[model samples]
Target: MASSPNIFGKAQADVLAETGTALLQIKNSRRLTLEDMARVLGRTDDMVAKYIAGEAEMGFVAFRRASEAWPELTEKLNGGAE
Candidate 1:
């Protein structure tokens, strides 16, 4: 069987990469290593690295879980929502 078309364009991929970079910065600012983040998200260190490198898309649940692990980023992530 043939593969499906690419729904996400280069621009979108770029944006995701940028977001991943930003998230990586946030994690760093918190003094958390990739292994620490992996433990928090119940993922492997490689998976965390991939997510931060924008090689993989982080689902909403993982994002939310990450925010929970670092409560400070939650407000900023959700636009100050409660």
Candidate 2:
């Protein structure tokens, strides 16, 4: 049987957790609901919620757009090094 992919490992997991926390914080600070974020990203609320919950992986394009649009997000959440 083929082994399943390890979704969460060391580095990636840490980044995902940090990103999720940051997204949540930003959402709370802006009084934006998951639906709001979904609208902004042109995605479904369920997808945004999944990303915030760390249940879904964010693609590089989406991540880059978000980081560019909300620099504070990466700074506050990802340690501001990127």
Candidate 3:
């Protein structure tokens, strides 16, 4: 099967990539391992890795879990000020 081009284009892709990197930074700052993140989000390590790699989008529930686990994540995502 063939895939269609991404309608969201480069800008959205860039944002997702930056988000992934930021999420990784947050995990690092928390001194968390991928396993720890998986437990926090109720996801498998592979899925967590994909979220941190920008290969998969975190759903609202996962996002909520992540934000709950790291309140600073919400601030950082909202542009580094709360």
Per-model TM-score, in order, reads 0.66, 0.74, 0.78
lDDT score, residue 11, model 1?
Answer: 60
Q: Any runs in candidate 3 off by more than 4 Å, and if so which?
A: 1-10
Q: What order do candidates take by TM-score, descending? A: 3, 2, 1
In angstroms, the error of model 2 at 52 is 0.8
Instruction: Write one digit per residue (lDDT tens) for candidate 2, span 1-82.
Output: 9544544444666667777888888888788888878777767899888888887888877777667757688688646643
Q: Per-prediction RMSD in angstroms? A: 5.2, 3.9, 3.8
Candidate 3 C-alpha lDDT tens digits along 1-82: 9553453454556656666887898888888899999999999999989888988878889989988888888777656853
Better of 2 and 3 by lDDT: 3
Better of 1 and 2 by TM-score: 2
Q: Candidate 2, which segments miss by more than 4 Å at Cα?
A: 1-10, 80-82
Question: Residue 25 lDDT in model 2?
Answer: 81
